[model samples]
Target chain A: MIKVQQEDFDVSAELAALAAGNHGIGGIVSFVGLVRDLVGPDNAEPALRAMTLEHYPAMTEKKLGDIEAQANARWPLEASLIIHRYGRLEPGAQIVLVACAAAHRQDAFDSCNFLMDWLKTEAPFWKLEETEAGEDWVDSRASDDAAAARWQAKPDRAAE
Target chain B: MKILYFAWLRQRIGVAAEEFDLPADVTTIDDLVGYLTAKGPGYAKGFAEPQVIRAAVNYEYVPFDHKLSNNDEVAFFPPVTGG
Candidate 1:
């Protein structure tokens, strides 16, 4: 499970579905990324009014599927879900959600981190935020690259 | 043919999508980038540093050496930045 949508999702409902199938599973880890009110120039204190997210439609889904496949290969996840939104979103809006269910806490935690890291660095999505200052396009952050690099260097996984 | 730009590529190219005829020798991503560079200053700047740029054809990520054909959708952009 990978979904890219434009509507807000119910995190609790998604977690329930992810957790329902595995009676043996002992842990479920979920991550929800929210749109922040502040982005861009620090001194200017930009108030993000809306965000428009663009993606390579067919390619985006494929890349996300690949990420899930990799996680499945590494861990014993009973189920997983990834939901991402597009179009204009307001501050405090949920942008993405990732949930992992595994037999142990370690697998769930590691898989969730791995998915989020890969998505941040490799997923094809562009964000444009309309702020008080003006419309500012978000840049690929160096920090995100570092986060992804950590997983890319995992001895068990091939280089991405 | 459709030409698509995403992320910083859209910022540099000044548009999300555009259309153009397939040029005679433009059969690879590199050739297309060169052709785009010749279009104007913005294009040249957009592709100023080609090493940092990546491309995809018809929604599949491909290297600069990837071959292309008529009516294909070609995209140019910086490394993906998403989460």
Candidate 2:
């Protein structure tokens, strides 16, 4: 499942829903992203503040679907879910959530990390952090692409 | 044609989205970028560092050689930085 919405979600409820299925799955891995109080590129702002998120409508869902499909292909996942929020948010507010279930801990952990890595690089979302200095849109970081590439490089090398 | 920009590219270009007519010979991402750079100073400035810009055709990440058609929606963004 993939979602992009303005409303906040219940983390416990989501985890329960994902875990309530058939008992074939033995492990579940989940991740939650939260808005930080400090602003600026590196959280260098003196006064902590809020954030606003923006995203493309059709593109966001399509990209997420692709990422989920990739994860399912790599692992025998019983279930998976990705939820990301849009609109204005404050410090400590949840920004995104990713959950994965598989037969082993390794698959679950890897898939959870993979989902986040791809989402960070490919998802069509932008953040505008407001601080004492004013509002500043965040810049793209090379680290995200590196994270995504780590998994992809193995296959690429094999093909080469 | 619909065009989208993200991350620092959006900030530098000063707009999130724009609509423009597809040029006749712009059959690839590289061609499209060249055409856009000629349109105005803002686009030229935004696309100045061509090597750093990443593109997607209809939400699928594409290389410069990727083919494009009039119906396609193209987006340009910088290297992603999310956790």
Cα lDDT over the full model 2:
0.84
| DockQ of candidate 2 (2 decimals) | 0.46
Candidate 1: the clashing residue pairs are: none
Q: In candidate 1, residue A118 scores what lDDT?
A: 88
Local accuracy of candidate 2 as per-residue lDDT tens digits, B1-83: 88998766777778888888788888899998899888778888999999988898887889999988888889997765443
Task: Give the per-residue Cα lDDT of candidate 1 at A4.
Answer: 99
DockQ of each: 0.64, 0.46
Find the 10 residues in a row with the least total lDDT in model 2 chain B: B74-83
- TM-score of every candidate relative to the true structure: 0.87, 0.86
Give per-residue lDDT, candidate 1, residue B76. Answer: 84
Model 2: residues with Cα > 4 Å off, grouped in runs? A39-44, A154-160, B11-15
